[model samples]
Target: MSRKRLYLRAGLYAEGRSDYDFLLPLLNRLLSSLASSLFPGACDVEDSLGIDAPYPAPSERAERIAAAIADRRAECTLFVIHADGAGDPRYARQSCLDPGIDAARRASPDVVTVPCVPVRETEAWLLVDAEVFRPWLGSDAHSALPAEPEREADPKLTLGRLLKVKEGRMRRKPERLYRLFGEEVSLEALRALPAFQLFEAELVEAIRAVARSQGWPR
Candidate 1:
């Protein structure tokens, strides 16, 4: 008797507009686009929760999301999305799963977890960007820096140093995503990268699988 529902877990611990700069918009677009392509709008997509604040901890974030879903009192499919960082992605996922697991045991199984490629998984994207800025750095790309700068210097040197100096900055944040792509590139670019695309495609499949398992929409 309840309408079908879909839950999206987004990661927003980065610079730029939390949802757009991070993963929510992309995930929503992918799921909606895929659903329309496959089912031609036969099903409706509703969010169980919207992320409005910065969460200090993933477990707390997961708990808040779980509470929102319970308040809806609707049967739904869940998809959790997050970037792997210094914190354990597995722990973040397990934390999200705990509440859903309990909910499912008391009700029905409808939650699925998918972890995206770590910075290591997408190293080529970083290498590509580095090569673009390398020429301007010249020998300075590897040179040691003065303790402090007295005057303005080349911008490329600053970027080169960031790429070399910050061991994890380029790797961890969602903003780096734009660095890999040209503005002209369509959303398809993410789908082109097996490292990036597979995670999303598989996530959709997981949601579909859960929905089917719940006997939703026949």
Candidate 2:
């Protein structure tokens, strides 16, 4: 197979550390997954704000990114972002969704942007992949996981509760989820989630369009 390479400049602005961390590795894996099979080759991501870098304020993120990209302060031809939908998807987009999209476009008219919101929380993506969670929750607590995770009001709460259940106690620690989703979860399983689907579709199409514009063959 002939592989095409995109000198991609990726920019990311996320709501929190966990999502920031989860978003980077997950995105790399996802890009690789899509590239090797779906497209011609690989997308090498370049972002001045490293994948593990700190995030800007949610409100100013779009404005900052637009300025950065325009000035080459942040170098990326494309931007991938993650911000919580927080209990309302409506507010989530207003806060960052439209702005992020607009900023990337303004920065580089052709730059492709994919901004993701986890509905209520990023933890919800983990639940879409049952097999991954089935192991983490163990056999005993496996039954406790929801069949339709997106329906749960606070999937993050369910994740925390499930972890606590495994240890035979309840605790409000967010680090556990941070570790589980960051370290052990599978991206392939995450493909089942609607959020992931939106991300994947947008990202793939962006690459394809960019490739066509750059005249790269698949």
Candidate 3:
């Protein structure tokens, strides 16, 4: 049997980091923003698969997730949920958040939940980081840049192609792209994207709310 893991100061949840590479850095950025006043100790995210299997039967899914979390209730203070906006982000993200919140509550009623679903997909937010894209574009960064990345229909495809331009034959696999963002890209550049804005605002507020509850200054 696995030893009982002592609880950390906090934690986060995402669908699959390998499948959605950008989300990890994005989540980390939020932690950086909140670390000083909100999460003083190390706070990290784990793929939800560790808690429950991917998309179990609808009837059993929530119960399974709740049970899993209850079994490991000591590992987190709250769980920030990461998902994609399959159709309409505002509406679609809730599909995951509602159930996730319920599941977390089963483990601890006070668990705070923050939901993020980049418009269309998280890749959509990356496209908006034109400062980083400029390096890839060489001379065409200004001209090749899309003015409305959020309006794009298939951002994942668009991002994959853009990444290839920087790397001749390499695909936008998780490690490669995540490395670029972590080591090369400028986080400030992404603030222009609406998806990032939403995430920033929601995360700031969530952290503030938690701070208030803990009687920490806002």
lDDT of 2 by residue, 1-218 (tens): 85656665455666677676656666665665666675544656543243322354234666655554454434555566667777776688788668756865765677666767777888787665545556545564446668777678988787766666544664434545564565556766667777667778888886676567667764
Global local distance difference test of model 1: 0.43
Which residue runs of candidate 1 sit more than 4 Å off their true CA positions? 1-21, 46-49, 52-65, 68-77, 86-108, 112-117, 120-185, 210-218
Q: For model 3, where is the 10-residue window of minimal lDDT?
A: 3-12
Top-down TM-score ranking:
2, 3, 1
TM-score of each: 0.44, 0.74, 0.72
Candidate 2 weakest ten by summed lDDT: 45-54
lDDT of 1 by residue, 53-77 (tens): 2344235554544443444334345
- Tens-digit lDDT track for model 3 on 142-215? 56756887788888787767767433654455566764664444566667777777777777776666556656
- Count of steric clashes across candidates, in order: 0, 1, 0
Identify the leading candidate in terms of TM-score: 2
Q: What residue runs in model 2 are displaced by over 4 Å at the alpha carbon? A: 1-4, 40-59, 68-75, 134-136, 165-184
- lDDT (Cα atoms) of all candidates against the true structure: 0.43, 0.63, 0.59
Clashing pairs in 2: 9-76
- The residue pairs in collision within model 3 are none
